[model samples]
Target chain A: MSSFEFTFWTIVGCGLVTWLSRIISFILLKKFRLPTSVIEFLSFVPIVIMSALWFESLFHQNLGHLPQVDVGNMLASLPAILTAILTKNLLWIVIIGILSLALIRLVI
Target chain B: MDDVLDARTGLKDTLPTVFGYIGIGLAFGIVGKASGLSPLLVALMSAITYGGSAQFVMVSMLVSHSTLLSIILAVFLVNARMILMSMTVAPYFRQERTWHVVLIGSLLTDETFALSMNKLNRTQNTLSFPWFNTANLTAYFTWIIASLIGALLGNFITDPKRFGLDFALVAMFIGLLYLQIIADQSMKKALQLTVVLVTCILMYIGLIFIPSNFLVLVVTLLSCGLGMVIKHVLF
Candidate 1:
């Protein structure tokens, strides 16, 4: 296939995959009752998923590489993590994280 | 009064998330443009795919000229967590129509799921679909508009990292995760959190051998499965 064809198909494929994942559970649960254990299992999904996202963003160099600790990201995360633990406010944590990173960038 | 209050509260509660979305969305736009995607295509991806991390992965893959199958598989695996998220929130929408449920499901994201679940757990009020929709729509529009703005300004703002904006998504995730932990507030829950975190870190380190895309889905399943097993065995 041509490059343009490949790009078009790739985006279409991605859009389909993403939409299917989002709506699959909704479709399935409509017909079948989720086992209580499965529901209980699913409850922990957010925490686990979010943690993976956090770690990948903080440590990973590229998409699927070994996570080397970046000094800037690590330093910024300290304040962000602390703010998260203390305030439990999403906005404050983001603000502190950005400001901390900016400062670190300036310093080094 | 209650409806207005709920709507207002929903909008108010989502402001932080909206802020985070704009920041990340703009970053995605810049990265997308830098990766050779047109501004229109970046906005289109933001609108259609609407998965932040997956879109980032897509852009990077595009830049590298990765195959279509690999790109699709990667995006699918990265977003596979949405199935669990959709199911978890399904119980709350049991009373709504199928169309409404589907609509809500389509709009589900990490931020929306966190906010909606938090509200459901705390309130005695029935799950207000409209209130949830308000949060979803606000974040949705913010993402699209910010992407367009970023694409338009992509030429001017060459280096987004200089301002440290790349860390916005990570900070938001950390904040949301902390909130989830605090809301649970039990020794057992804390242990469960620890189990999940440990599992994710181990799997992340294991990425040296495993393909990154596959590891994410595997880690999510294994970690959440571990949490379930622990809850059953211990509690």
Candidate 2:
């Protein structure tokens, strides 16, 4: 198939499945009740997922190299972490983080 | 007053994601164009699939000349975590109409899910649909616009990382995790710290063996299961 044809079909299939993945669990759970324990467990999902994502981002891995802490992200996190503690505000944390990293990049 | 607050909160909460999306979305567009996709098609892909990593994977696969079937399958695997995420948030939409539930599900993505989950917990399991829809729409449009601009500016623009735009999402995740931990009073502080610490170590180890496409989903499941067991034993 041509490149355009290939890209088109791939996108169509992907979009369908992507939408399905997001909606399937909701559809299934609506017909059946989730156990109380499962609901309780779900409460922990946000923190676990966030921590995993953060770690994946903050640590860098390359072919044949052991994962190493990202110095830039680590340094940037200082001010962002302080902001989170000080105000617990999302926007402030993000702003401080981006600006911190930008300045760090500028300096180094 | 309450409705206005809800809408304002949604926009406020989405700010970080909007920043992150612009960087990543522009990067994705440039990559797509480099892979020989038309600018229009690149934006359409963002509008359609709307999965950031999946789209990137797709373009890379295109460059490598992977079959259409494999590309679709890879996209599914990369995005499979959304199933677990969707289930976790499903209970919130139980009272809404079916159509609304479907809308909520499709709009769900990693960043938005994390943001909405925290907001839901803070508000005692109540999140206004309009609030979430607002967040989703903001992210969605920002992505489309960014991608289009990147594609149009294709060769002229260099790397997105020079300005440290890539770190925006990482910082946002850090902030969100901190908030989630502080907002939850049920678990002991020590246990919460343990969960975060262990998950990080396990994920680092997992990355050594598992493909990143599946690593996040696996680590999240294993870590959350451990957390539940610990919480069950204590308090």
Candidate 3:
């Protein structure tokens, strides 16, 4: 298939998968109750996923490669991490992160 | 009407989400456009997928010319947590019409789920549909608009990275993680952070063997399973 055709179908497929994953549980759980253990287990998913994402962003480069630290990204993340802990504001964290990265770039 | 008042309250409460969405959504659009997606296509993805991280993954995968199946699977895995999130919030809508419940289910996102669940837990009554609906809609539109504007400005402003917009997603995730940590405030807070850190380290090590796309799913299940086991043993 052509690239455009590929992109279109891929996006459509992704949209379908996303919607299905989200709605299916809502439909299923309406009738049945999950075990308390399972619910408690699931509560940890977000923190795990978010941490994985954060680490992947900071470290991973491409498929099947060892993690390589990008100094700029890592240095910039220090201030963002502090802002997140201190301010606990999403917008501020993003703003401070971007500003810190820009400043770091200017300096080094 | 009561519906209007509830919506107004919901919107007022969603101001922080609005700001967060605008920043990250604009970054998504800019990255999408920079990676050669058409402005309309970028906006369309935001509308249809309505997933922040998944859409980012989609753009990167597209740029790398990854297969359609891989792209679909990656996006699915990254967003699989939504199932857990949706199920968690589903009980609150037990009294609502099935159609309304389905509509609300479709609009579920990490941010909305977090906010709505917190509100539900604190409030005495069932969460009014309008209250939750209003907050979802505000974040939804804010994301769409921010993305469209970013895409439109993509041609004129060539380098988004110079402005450090590339870090937006990571920063947002960090902030969200912080909120999750603080909101729990359990005595196990340190243990929870340790689990997250250990899982990330393990996933990083797993990169040598595991495909990059599957790493998130594998690590999520592993870490969460480990956490449950530890919690079960301790408490």
Instruction: Name the best candidate (by TM-score).
Output: 2
Residue B98, model 2, lDDT: 82
Ranking by DockQ: 2, 1, 3
Per-residue accuracy of model 2 over B1-235 as CA lDDT, tens digit each: 0224266778877887888898888888888887789998899899999998788888888788888788889999889889889998887777778877888789788899988867765676677678888888888899999998889888988777777777778788988899878876766788888889879888889877777666788898898888888777764
Pairs in steric clash, model 1 = none
| Each prediction's number of clashing residue pairs | 0, 0, 0
Off by over 4 Å in 3: A1-9, A88-91, B1-20, B34-36, B56-71, B114-128, B185-187
Write the candidate numbers in order of decreasing TM-score.
2, 1, 3
The TM-score of candidate 3 is 0.81
TM-score of chain B of each: 0.87, 0.93, 0.78
Per-residue CA lDDT of candidate 1, range B73-122, in tens?
88998888788788888777777788888888888888888777556545
lDDT of 1 by residue, A7-84 (tens): 667778898988888888877777789887887777777778778777766555454556677788878989999998
DockQ of each: 0.58, 0.66, 0.54
lDDT per residue as tens, model 3, B1-235? 1223388878876665665677678778888888888888888888888898799889999999888898898899888877767776776677777777777888888777766644543364357789888988998898999999889887776665676666766676677677667766442787778788778787778776776566777887789888888777765
Of the candidates shown, which would achieve the greatest lDDT relative to the real structure? 2
Docking class of 2: medium
When candidate 2 is compared with the true two-chain complex, its DockQ is 0.66
Please give, as one word, the docking class of candidate 1.
Answer: medium
Residue pairs in candidate 3 whose N, alpha carbon or C atoms collide under 3 angstroms: none
Which residue pairs collide, candidate 2? none
